[model samples]
Target: MDPILLGAIFITPIAAIIIIGLIWYQKWNYTFKDLQHIKGPTPLPIVGNMSELGDPTKIFWQLFNWQIQYGNIVKGCYGMDMLLLISEPEYLEFICTSQSTLPKGIFYRYLHKWLSFGLLTSKGKKWHQRRKMITPAYHFKILEQFVEVFEKNGNILVEKLRGEVGNPSFDVNIYLTLCALDSINETAMGTSVDAQNNSNTDYIRAIKEMNRIVVDRTIQPHKHFDFLYQFTNDYKIEQKCLKILHSYTLSIIESRRQELLNNPSRFDSKYVDEFGMKKRIAFLDLLLQSTIDGKPLSNEDIREEVDTFMFEGHDTVSTCMSFWMYLISKHPEVEAKLLAEQREIFGDDPKRPTTYLDLQKMHYMEMTVKETLRLYPSVPFMMRDTLEDFTFRDLSVKKGTQILMLPFYLHRRADLYPEPEKFIPERFTAENMSKRHPFAYLAFSAGYRNCIGQKFAMIELKSTLSKVLRSFNICSAVPEHNLVIKSEIILAAGNGYKIQLKNRTW
Candidate 1:
């Protein structure tokens, strides 16, 4: 072979490589110019900033550090997707109150299969119609019926704590979660899951597993693509989980649909039983009768709303209440205040169940719950995609950019809340809250797309906590098991909510 021929072959390939590299650099520069002013951590070639966010358990805190080091509107990446995490109050208010009605950001794509076009995941006309129809289901009259469910479930929880009264400490997360599951299921589906008694039930297991998988998939970028995900074992497990979740939800929908045919007026209005008491109407019963564009909602459509209710209702309340138990335990003064308030409402009869009026009288507990939410919100963060370009805080965000709202850190801002890390229920007093930014505390999120079940969740939490505090005294673990907070699809405690209980002697 001639030396000239060999040189020509090697040189040609090297020249091509240079040309391709230059073309790629030019494209990257052009795209980033719109966001050129935004400051953020440097990204790697393919994974972007995912290496820094490698651990799901610590990603939220990691992002918080980035926000502090970079700025309030920290620009970063999740794999190839750009994520703009906002903590500034003005920016949060603008994004939330304006474009929130836009579809949920990319993170919700994974939830579509399980929750699917439910009020949480739906967008556009579908979301508007569904929101209109679903609003009535959570009416004061309808919600009034759920108080009985809460009390009955709360009593079961109080009775169950008897077995753990003498133990030094145990993870009470499961107890609270199952109790919530039982209560939400009874109200949402009108079926008795009795999750507290049968903790090993399939529905409960599937929900737990699905929660893990949603977080798992979010962090692992490769799983984002269905084509790539289908080849992995997690994909298989996800399918199995979906089968259990959807089948059970659908089964109850069908059962209730058939049951309604026999009664035909269950959803008409809350009817009175022979005992002259108003009967309860489950969330599912209302959805069964609802229609979209004059066509009755299909079973699939009804299941979407019911399943969404289960996730939001049970997971949101349980996580918040669990934190309250831990926070209340750590601050004995807080616990004393809570118990005193309980007495004021129930008049020394702690065993008496709470009514709607009773929940209203829980002014102190309401403030405490609000403060707990500020410290550790039920949903740690909310994600949204901008439908139109917007400018805020002198920063211009492009359309199609993903906005990750970090309520976890927003509420932690020292500038916003003095001694932000401390448990101060008074921070939520009428006077204090009025002085604060409305968007500063986003436990239930903000704006048009805020959590629809907010009132329902508050009622369940206050009633349940009132019942538990009345019967038992919750104390922190002997060795001090600190809650390792993690932001998953919902806020989660990696270490579990560990506490001891003593039978109330008052």
Candidate 2:
């Protein structure tokens, strides 16, 4: 071989080995040493505690046990990457409340391909601007207008349950989910999706498939890397789902844009209802009319928010409603008290449309929802990326570390909630709440990035449940102990929420 070629071959291999060694040292040596003080399950060589996540179906329980075994804060790893799992209320309060702890970590990136920068995944100045712009869409006044949509859907749900009355253990999940989709689409997209009417829309199916893929990816740590995940069939399926979802949202945006162009007066806020009162516009219209620093939201920007709202708005509240109904069925005394309150508010009218004032008066129902959330938060856990070097009590975390906050475990802490496993709505009464830590309960999360649609969700919950309760008495077929639960971004019962509805004789 020529002298130059021989020299190049030797040096290149040596340099490559050195580079790999340094990368390994940084990840395995330095990172592990820095977090050695924090208590957690021991990690293996390259995989770390990745396998500790074991079966995807049982991962939630494993993590819950770990949260107890390792104390409020435990350090774990996926490969050399570190994670700080937290269930402490004070620590959680700090993490959520502080302005600096806003950027979501790598996990949320999984949702980005679907959600884009629509509030849930956006960060920094862009997030702030979007938050401000979209804030008005969920305002109390705006949500008040959505009451008509909620009422229509609530009545639809009640009527649909008529045939199922006295049935033995029918799953209500599909019914509630469809009702939510219809209500949210009408309010969020300026149109009716007719999901409750059983419209076989690809968009709805895509949403369900996309959520399953996200859960699959999350539980399988090896699929975290894009390079490897790209080769998997799930990724291909996810792409197809995204196409359907995006196409649907884009079409809606185009339709609304054309409608506004043909009738400029529709863009104006002067339209009066039959009562001569100005009607509130759809969420899509609000986004179209909004300007942030002189620029209106693009179709893409508007689509992201619309898609985000569609995903977040419907399933979350619907899931909560499912549990709310199940819990009521399990506790007859609680249901009796709840029915009494509803009767007091609306009198004997089973078809009374729930108003903003009526929803506000459903105080006990709100507490029951709160207690249900404490046991089963819609979004079970949240992750945040460290923006800077951080310290927690005796432990230190470097910049770029991922933080996992577990509201599921925190809400059930024995120190905070006295019989943590019991179904007690009175635990949230004003006096009891005042005595507890403000951050002890985080049903819709907490702090700056806390759920923007919380008020809207609460109203939807009360309205839907109030309507159903007025017409039918709900009972669950499965006992609380018999229910098998799992976490998939949102908590779900593995066997489904099976219940029987009996028409109220009064």
Q: What are the Cα lDDT values of the candidates?
A: 0.85, 0.85
Top candidate by TM-score = 1
**Residue lDDT tens for model 2, 1-506:** 99999999999998887775567557655544766666888776556677877566877887788889989888877665667898887888888876557898777888889999889999999999999888877778788888888999998898888989978788888899999999999889878878878657887888898898888887787678899999999999999999998998899998888887887676666787568877558999888888889987789999999999998998899999999888888888999999899889878676767889998899999999999999989988889987887666765667777788888899999999998999999998999999998988888888898999999999999999888988888887756535688888788888888888898875
TM-score of each: 0.93, 0.93
Where does candidate 2 stray beyond 4 Å?
1-25, 32-37, 273-278
Model 1 regions more than 4 Å off: 1-34, 273-277
Model 2 lDDT, residue 483, Cα: 62
* Model 1 lDDT per residue over 331-393, tens place: 889889988888787785768767999998999999999999999988887889878767666
Candidate 1 positional error at 308, Å: 0.9
Q: For model 1, what is the error of residue 299's alpha carbon versus the real structure, in angstroms, after optimal superposition?
A: 0.5
Clashing pairs in 1: none
TM-score of 1: 0.93
